[model samples]
Target: MPIDLSLLDDDQRIAATAPRGPVCILAGAGTGKTRTITYRIAHLIDQGAVSPNKVLAVTFTQRAAGEMRDRLRAMGAVGVQACTFHAAAMRQLRYFWPQVAGDLPWRLLDNKFPLVARAARAAGLSTGKDMVRDLLGEIEWAKSSVIGADEYPQRVAEQRRTPPADADKVAAAYRLYEESKSSPDGMLLDFDDLLLHIAGALENAPAVAEEFRAQYHSFVVDEYQDVTPLQQRVLEGWLGQRDDLTVVGDANQTIYSFTGATPDYLLNFSRTYEHATVVKLQRDYRSTPQITELANTVIGKAVGRAAGTRLHLEGMRPAGPAPTYHSYDDEPTEAREVAAAIRGLIADGVPAREIAVLYRINAQSAALESALADAGIVYQVRGGEGFFHRPEIKEAIAALVRAARRDDLPEDPVAVARAAFAPLGLTRNVPEGAQARERWQTLSALVDLISDIVAGKEAASLVDVLRSLRQRAEAKQAPAVDGVTLASLHAAKGLEWDAVFLVGLVENTLPISYAVKAGTEEIEEERRLFYVGVTRAREHLHLSWALARQEGGRKSRSRSRFLDGIAPDLEVESSPQRLKRARTCRVCGTPLETPADKALARHQSCEPDYNEDAYLALKAWRLETAREAQRPAFMVFSDASLMAITEAMPATPAELLDVPGVGPMKVEAFGPGVLETLAPFRSG
Candidate 1:
């Protein structure tokens, strides 16, 4: 059966078509973009606008691709081409490699470290294993920006403070990378090679390009703002001269600029397409009006940013509460207050899964999780308990030290290693072995020079040597971060949660321990960090920090600056003094009351045995649950929510989240079990 486009509104109708020329759908989060793009592909197949084999749909995530496929079937269409950018590129490169490049190699490398290392060796530079990584990054960034080796200096000169050996360095490495991968020998493809190969195929083989252009005829890209030049070239090849293209993305959500993605692609949509249809999905269904306002305010005024060409959000939802503003004396206090709110919410019937805690860094989760437990909010931390155990961060750390000792450390490796060290209490002063000594030296050198490298530019002083190194060592692949929920700000992109809590908004944490001078690039990234944090919240949002915690009985701490801006009319309070039992009158044997109902209730007997541990535990739990919300936990509840659980004692699934701390998803995941467990005590 043919799919229906008539029922959709104007924006949706344009979104449904197997269009004639280029189309851009500038959608915000929760704007039915996936629906529109999926339906468009289904419509194309049903209308016989393009052959199924020729059609292509590139989404950011694999999960998105799967959902698009399911939606096509539901709409009575099947097997329209759809996949992630990586998956799509791999298919085309594999199919036409022989015709395009003559001979087939086993595979291409994504990391391209080997190529960088080889180039460094050829250049007569003395370096270590990790330099390969930097060279690859430099090449990838250059390639993404569509800057050829000849024109690299003028275009990126301002951007680079500590320049490498001009365009020749990257060009040389790129040539070596090409030789190693496409030399009819190896079978390994790193991430970027997939795109480069397909682009290579299109550029070299005119016939293959024509076939793809004629067959696919139409196109759609999700997160269009994130498209690199390589991706844009591939997209152009797919559509050819035809404007049968539709792109959906928000420049505001352009948080991936560091990865060589540019929102300029989205900004210049009109220039690329003969006729561009621009629409916005600004009517966000995910956040409340309060959250949306904050998002608009923060992003709308972002300075030194390119002006948005044409952007608007329609059909906004009704207003909600003013986002609660709070600032505590330190990380612990902030975490505790956030937990209290979660507890309060659970007590009011919200579920644990419905709340999320956000933060600026991965390292901040330690204090947050600790506080949640103290508050009895059993949250599942993102990626899990053994993050420092990650092979890559540690290896990179160790590798950086080896390289740094040899003067070959890269920024990413050093950053990874340094963050991992704070918790381990590891210091460079005590070098354990050759490996340790090498890593320690690298870290030691970096630490000494970091204050001056306030901007990431100065940090590039060690680039050439490091770039030559990581590229050479292919085995230095860092381990993947693992946890039930994510704990790092870097890993939280393109992801969302039912509830969000952002902890450690202080100047040093969110803005970070790195980046001392706080230049434009670093600050903008920080803003984007906050922007990402804000968008992750679907229903509820929280921001917090700690007052104090005893780590070896040292009580020195500072609160996050982000908390200071919003927490209006700050009130710092302490635990009220406990009543004295010895003040009873002799005639009535009553405790004298100075205030409320004191005279009437004074005759009641005094209770004994204060549960300090229980009270402190509850207090601690409140702070913990409010730092970040990145994962689903076992039993599907947060610790602060559990305190709410203990307090409310609901007897049924229907009554579970009604107890104040529960979230919608948590209720679905563990509502019944939690209810059953607590039902026995309801009668008591």
Candidate 2:
């Protein structure tokens, strides 16, 4: 369906329909930046201002590019090239490889770490994998910043940047790396080379560059604030003096500076393109008023010109409960409490899939993962291997691909899938462990997806479907499963959840000890990270910190300064002692075991919290439904299940099923009455 321009807000309409020359959108967190970019592409196509094939949209990641393509395709503007900077450059380089750098027979080195390690060894460096990785990172930073071998030391000294331990060894390794790449025997280029080579070609080879400029006459750059010097060089090369470009970014979210990305490109876009149309998008639709306020508060305290001006978010959603702040005894206790909170929410009817637990670093996930497992609440880690990459799942995928190649199998892909996996013993010889069970669930999901795709298509063949499936499998794509998400703050960018727990908000954790020592700029980046985590919540936001480490022998820590920046009015603060016993009944002085207990414990005639009334109503309905069905009340609805229902207050049967324990069986049995009990609260 064609997008109706009238549906957009005033700012969005201006962003989407701006005169098509140089444009810059200062989009804040959750301001529908993606929507604006997609709409701008659609608007241009709809207005016949640019052909679909003539436009190019560049994103930071392949996943983001895929999302952009899906959005543009949905808006009926197909054929626009949406891809990463590296991908676009690689395509152009490959097409012009025969013309520019002849017969070198170069191949892109996807993993540069091994090469760096090799060069380090050649340089006689006695370093561990971690140290080598750091050196490789410095190398990447140097390359992206356009720093060459001769200028490496001068650049580091000029910027007051601390060189890696074994600085001399690292420099030697860098020299070796450059030599190896320039040698005839090692005709390999790193990811940075993809942009550098293409930009070099454009700068030196005008004919080849002009051909591309003419081919992609218009452009859109997403996340422009993270563009490095090399990326900007390529963008400039492609733009060549044309003003048909749109850049969308948030300067406050410039968190990738370690990799040489600077906010200068976005901050100076107006100065560069003298007549650039700048639009500020402040309407945050992804977070509650409380969350938006907290984010604004964090960013407001940021120092330096890069902080830009803090844009106060005009929240699009209604007022939600005040954001919760919790202080825990230790990391384990924190993880356990977070897990319990997640469980309570799910039982109250919030879908497990709608909740997320975010942390400052990857190490924090281990304790949380263990706690969630002990609680029997399923969860998927964002950057971990995940269920799709499990050994059993990988084996099943390989078997299916082998089966797909057989000429004797049925032409329909679904039939081929059945024939392939049934004999693989995925269902018959189920594993006994939790990880194995998760893998089994992953396999079942893949089979269902294939069946659904082939069900209505008469012409679908095994080969074509297998090809698509294989591509997705290779991409490490995991099908959606019912589970809470655990992700690092960096990984949680561009994603939001209904309930978000920002865990490990201690002094050294959020700003990190390293950032504290690095000076002002690094501390500012840490605040930006906190700002990012704060904005990734829609309705509920819970911020937590551990007083001590879970591992023995650590001193007690203070709360992060970033947390101190948040206004007290915007959060409901509690210490470990308070959160543990805070729910005791006011009149009876009894510690309520559950939301249901608290509801029933309240003085009958006295005024109570609205949630208590809703919980009482849900419990009554669940008991009656269980009695009528001749089932145990627990089977009809577990306390956790009932709690989730009460809290979520789902209005429809489908929404009711989103609560973790309300699977198809429960939904079929008790959904109508559940909806009835929730209808009044849902309206409120």
Candidate 3:
């Protein structure tokens, strides 16, 4: 039976039906981008345009790939291969290793931390564990960008990145690590080496490359904006000049630039393929109109190169309560209020699991977690020791992976999984406590996936099943357990919850003090990070900042300047003390019903005591002046500038140029209009 295409929106339908060339789907948050990709796959198979077996779908994480496969199966589009970049490369390398070279080198090392530590010690560097970890991370990053140890210093310098204090020592350690990897008796390939080797093989071996491309006729990539340059090169090698590709991502959410991922590829997709079909999915079904507006307004300030024609999202959902903003006297008060709000939300029928508390840095979680615990609320740190990384779970998976290597294909992979976990006190029978039950459920889900793959003929061997499980584990994709989630903004990417508490919106937190000094790129990424956090909310969003915090001692702080960048009309601020007077529209003296109403009124009514007509006239003149100058209206004179102009009633060009954001350059251009616009409000 063919799947129904009627469910998709018109733009989505167009994206799904774009024929066989480079297609870029600019999907915003909650725009059903996933649905479009899955439907496109189903359509390709159902329409006999491409065999399900010949389609290769790639996602950033194993969890995403698994979800895609599940969705495809539901749509009756079976046999499609969905996997992460590393998984795909590993499979190809494993299958063609013999033909390309001789036997494969040493087995894949699961953890490189210990090896790195050993290398550091071998290099006579007695660094702390944290320093060693940082060194190892730098090495991994260098490798991911295809930079070898020899080229590390030069690349670091060119990028303007500060070299490690002990740069030579770290480099020596890195070289030692590389030598250990290529030892005569053994050699090890880490996760990134999988992509690096596969790309190299395809580049050098034309026959292998041709055969691989011929085998997989169609390609679909999810989260394309988070792809690194090396990954893009791999995709190019896989395509081999064939434009049978569909890439979907949001450029505005490109917060992983630090990890070598760039949104340039996604943003420039049309430029790369002149004939590529580009479609924008703007209808956001997740957030309220107020929330969507705030998201759009926040990202609009992004001056980064990747910030293209602001793809503003149109909210399809009904308007909800305006996102609340709060200012606290101290960090403890902020945490307490956030906790109280969570309790209130749960009391109001929002599930605890549906609520999440997000912060800019992991350190901020300490207070929030403490507050939640005091309130008897169960919460899980999103990226901290996920289900697949749990000690017991890792042991069980190791046993299952070993069993999968044996030619004996078990009828019930779930049963094998059960046996593997039995030693760890995890079994098919019901577990005792809530936590145990959850763990058992996660294991059962993993086994069920393997069983389904086997039953559906998606796996040709037990090894393949093992490989799939291992890949998913490495990808850190775990089932969503029932608990309030606490995560850093970076870890919360590609995930959402009902109510989000964006705590720690203070100055040194959001834009972060280090990012402020780092330069424009860092600041831009920080803004993108804030955008990611805001868009994660499907319903209620609360942004909060503390005026003071007590770590060593009470220190005064202010709200982030990024918050200041958000259009004045998007947020309303509040504190413990209620407003002494009723908030009324300054223009008409009407009571403001809500924060959204107040924000709108504030934007509309600048300088309430002054002549209203003068403010309006000044705004009109500023708009016209901006249009004439081919600049944003704010450049001509900010709303604040207009408000000042209306109040001061600057009659002369010199006085008009004295207004904020107006300089000598402005006096040569729009100063006369500024004076003329102010004349109506000026008393002769």
Candidate 4:
């Protein structure tokens, strides 16, 4: 059978037909790398270079592996083993464990959290959920980086990692975790241990290595940039000393560094195998010219190992609309406006499913979910549940339903809901850790929904709110599968849409504050992440950022640095410029002399002489009002507004409206209580 080269581009054809010892295809995003790799496998088989059964193709995901197999089958190249590294390792381990280890293999531990908790107890560390999750992440990173328990502390320091616990404790927990896996009561092997055991087996047993090498004569690794050190060791073990290998990846798409994946192997492939055929596939067929240019610019600024090998993608598609930039006063405004834009795009004949809103983190979805719901738009969150289907939201809804059935039901449904949710960890301050913050955001969204419901219909009871929630959830789960997509940027990789709304582009969120602290390599990875998000767009690309976390908060945030060089008409302030700016007193219009004055934005003498009693009363009233309305207390009236009112002693409606944060709508909603609270402290 003749393998056709007619369908491949020049670069692709070259990569597909390259002579077989060691080949590295530097395939940029949307460059048809998969097709080229499959073609190469078929060509190898057709050329009689390797038997189909003796060729092994490995990728990062099971779906990708399946697709590779499917493609190979379509090309008349069957019997080749296509699977993930873990799958291949597990298969080999299953077959050879009895012969090598003198007994049947241990049960594979599907979830490591329970065992991690046990390990934490043995190590005298905190067993909190977030702590355990972080520790598990650390242990996995250490294992993937090929660092042993004894070396974990030094590695943590070298890597400048902010571990969940002290380095010694984390290492202790890791050691205990390893010990527990082999204990008499606990005969378990985790996913990481699979690769380790297999590598160890091959290293210790020459006969096993010989048999394994003889089993697979040729190998193809996809997404080679994401191969961890541990996976690399297993690959090395499998190869013995053979160099008949093909690795295809884009160094710019190397965004999984936190998972211990690195691009060193892919970048250094030619150096490692001096005669390896290195082919660069630069033409991007997924995005438009505007998008490709943006993607190139994003990665062009990267300054690290990946930068040296970054592929300058050429857009193969026709020119499209220039990417748009947006700035918002606050996050809610950003989400609302972005959702509105998505709705408008859908109205302009774009299919709802063809538009997506991507953000930096999972917690960012809660606001977008609310705004989309408010706009009467349907959406599905990719790589996660729709907002209503989240565990925290479901738990909150159940609690609300339980409260609705109470015999001593309060007049205010919001109060009943708050009292019910309080025990479940609903708080004013957002919790630490990604998992906990996401949970808090979900609960907070629920509270916001209840507020909206009650505000829309003053007569709505606790039962009515629950009914509304149920209706919303049902609507989301309806047969309309063409809803818009809401996803995190990381989740949006390898996915494309006609229109993309890249929201939450603020400095702290995108580069993310921690990435900034982690030094240049992490920052470069963040840049590549932005490039990945940008390349995900086919035509319409809308980038946006907000200046504040909440509606009335100070406009203190800056747009992501990745956007500084790309976005037009935007003057981004450098760190030095931002720091050098003077803080002036809001009351006197003069420079602040002290840190406290600067923080308060007012001098001591210029500060408003507010009535403390009246301010306290207003706070209490705000809390009760928030509970009754099923809203965050800050939404009722920020403490600043309360203080302003007490100081100004707003006696009439007009005066109350003059105070900051006290708008007409708020004055109309809770005016009576606010005025009443200030009455006792009024000056004669």
| Top-scoring candidate (TM-score) | 4
lDDT of 4 by residue, 223-295 (tens): 9999999999999998888899999999899999888999999999999999999999999998998899988
TM-score of 1: 0.64
Off by over 4 Å in 2: 1-3, 385-480, 551-555, 565-684
Scored by Cα lDDT, where does model 4 land?
A: 0.83
Q: Which ten residues in a row have the lowest lDDT in candidate 3?
A: 569-578
Locate the minimum summed-lDDT window of 10 residues in model 2.
Answer: 569-578
Clashing pairs in model 2?
A: 347-640, 347-643, 347-644, 348-643, 348-644, 348-645, 349-644, 349-645
Question: What pairs collide in candidate 3?
Answer: none
- Candidate 1 stretches with Cα past 4 Å from truth are 1-10, 17-19, 46-48, 110-136, 147-156, 161-189, 309-321, 336-349, 373-388, 392-484, 512-518, 546-684
Residue 52 C-alpha lDDT in model 1: 68
lDDT of 3 by residue, 1-684 (tens): 977889999999999888877899999988999999999999888888899999999999988999999999998888999999999998998887777767645569888878888888887875544446566777777777777887777888789765443566767888988777786675688888788878888899888898898899999999999998789889988998799899999988888876678888898899899999999999998898989999998888889686664589898888898988887666666787888899999999999899999987655665575567657666788876544555545666787777676653344555455545554545424443323444554455445445555655766565676776565544433236677888889999989998999988877567866677678898888988999999999889999887655422233566788888552422223433322456667567767777755644453544467766787887778777778878888766666656766766777765664454444555676777767766655764
Off by over 4 Å in 4: 374-376, 395-434, 437-474, 478-480, 550-554, 570-608, 611-684
Candidate 2 lDDT over 1-684, as tens digits, reads 556989778998999999889999999999999999899999998988999999999999999999999998888998999999999999998998877888778898877777778888898974445456677888888899998877888888888777665566667888888777777654788888888889998888988888888899899999998999999999989988888999999889989988899998899989989999999999998888888888888888888976555567888899998888887666767888999999999988889899999887664665676568768787888866553455555676788678666665445565456545654433423333323333444565556556544653522876666665555444433336778998888899889899999998878677877678779999999999988888989998998887666433133577899877562422223443324344565446656667655656554544544486787787888788778888777777876677767767777775675565555555666788788778887677
- CA lDDT of every candidate: 0.58, 0.77, 0.76, 0.83
Error of 4 at 250 (Å): 1.0
Error of 2 at 262 (Å): 0.8
Clashes of each: 98, 8, 0, 0
Error (Å) of candidate 2 at residue 74 is 1.6
Angstrom error at residue 600, model 2? 61
Best by lDDT: 4
By TM-score, rank the candidates, best first: 4, 2, 3, 1
